[model samples]
Target: MSFRRVIIGLLCLAGLAVVLDFGAAAYSEYRVSRLLRDGSDLGADPEVTFHGFPFVAQALDGQFRDIDIRARAVRPDIPGEILVEAGLIGVHAPLGDLVDGNVRKVPVDEVHALMRIEPVELGRLFKIPDLQVFGPPADKSDGSGGSGGTGVTTSGPIILTGTVSLTSDTNPVPGTSDSGKPVSVLADLRLDADGQIQIVATDIYYGDEATPAAMVPEVNRELVLAKFTRTIDTRDLPFGVRPMKVEASGGQIVVEGVGKNVTIDLDRLQQP
Candidate 1:
């Protein structure tokens, strides 16, 4: 056989090997996605992406460096839909066990995740059906939103009513006899000791986003702030994502979490 022919055969074999590796990785990703969706009770299959090529090597070695996942509607049993973007780091799962469909426990060195909290969650927690979170006031001098001008932190917007009215009605404005007093939620999102989102509204400006008005009545000041100032329970989440930082982004609240040296027990993904 010619030397060139031998070289060509070797090249073909290498190409086939690469194709097979990708196929295997794709299959594994599909299987893991299904498990995550059903086990976590997510609305649909979570997007799973394995890091690095030659995934077969990682599987044979039984250690995965990183795996990214984006899941919509996680923890359906919990109030409000939860969206999740997570990364699994240093996972340990043998290929044989996984192939046999007997794989159960998936231990990871760390799991970093971002949980996007939609308006519905805040509405239920804040007792406002139409709660709106917005970016800092366009005019910094207006003080409609909070970012301290540096723009690192953010706050939610409040169209106040209910006890906020104080005059009579206890429902959100527009429903109250008086028109809805537009209040921007200048709240600082913090995680309480219990891992709950503790929103402390530092102040509220009564006006639309474009226009900034005087602060509400001092007596009504604390009253209006009180409606948004409270620790909300969100401990019940899929994949055991623990809250780290809660911030307002693009008119929404997103809480980032990280779990270190975590073990995923597929049987009790929810544990509820």
Candidate 2:
């Protein structure tokens, strides 16, 4: 064979290899997405991306270095839809099961997921009108100069703003003579042991102005404070991931968690 012919043949082989690799990646993504959709019953299609080169080799080894799945507008048994992004690390699934469409269970070494809850949904959860949640401010060194004593300064407090309805029958807050009226409030957002979000009122002001607490009737102030001192259940998160942190920012709530050794079935992805 001529040297030029040999070079052309090698180039053709290289091109064929590239095409095969691309096909393998696409197939892998399809299989994973189908498996997740069948297992999770997600509302929309789940996007799956297999990391690393030569996806077929990873399939042969029955282990993947990383797999990312983004599920959009997932409607769980919660108040509203949430967007979930799951990162599956060290996923193990045999090639035979995947090919035969018998992938019953997938084991992952470490799983991290983020669920985004919009402000409208948060309002529903809090049962408040015109509710808006903001993300926590950046942590900063304590501005208070200590006496160089045993006290150490840390981060600042988290402040959140929202509106709450006050009623005479249920809660007769002092400032409003009307039975039911909307009151603006500033509260602190936190998570409890049962993975629920807690809202504790810090200050109650009139309208958008920072009115003095004394100006509002003491009885009404207490009632307003009591209205916001409640915990919201957020344990209905998907993928059985534990709720770790809750952040309110950009008129949305972001809940993050880590899942360890989660097992998902292929048959229940589309169910309610």
Give each prediction's root-mean-square deviation over alpha carbons.
Answer: 5.0, 6.8
Candidate 1, residues 22-88, lDDT tens digits: the string is: 9998888888778766776666777888898779899989988998888777343336666767788
Instruction: Please tell me which predicted candidate would have the highest TM-score against the true structure.
Output: 1
lDDT of 2 at 246: 76
Residue 117 Cα positional deviation in candidate 1, in Å, after optimal superposition: 0.4
lDDT of each: 0.65, 0.62
Write down the lDDT that model 1 would get. 0.65
Note the clash tally of each candidate: 4, 10
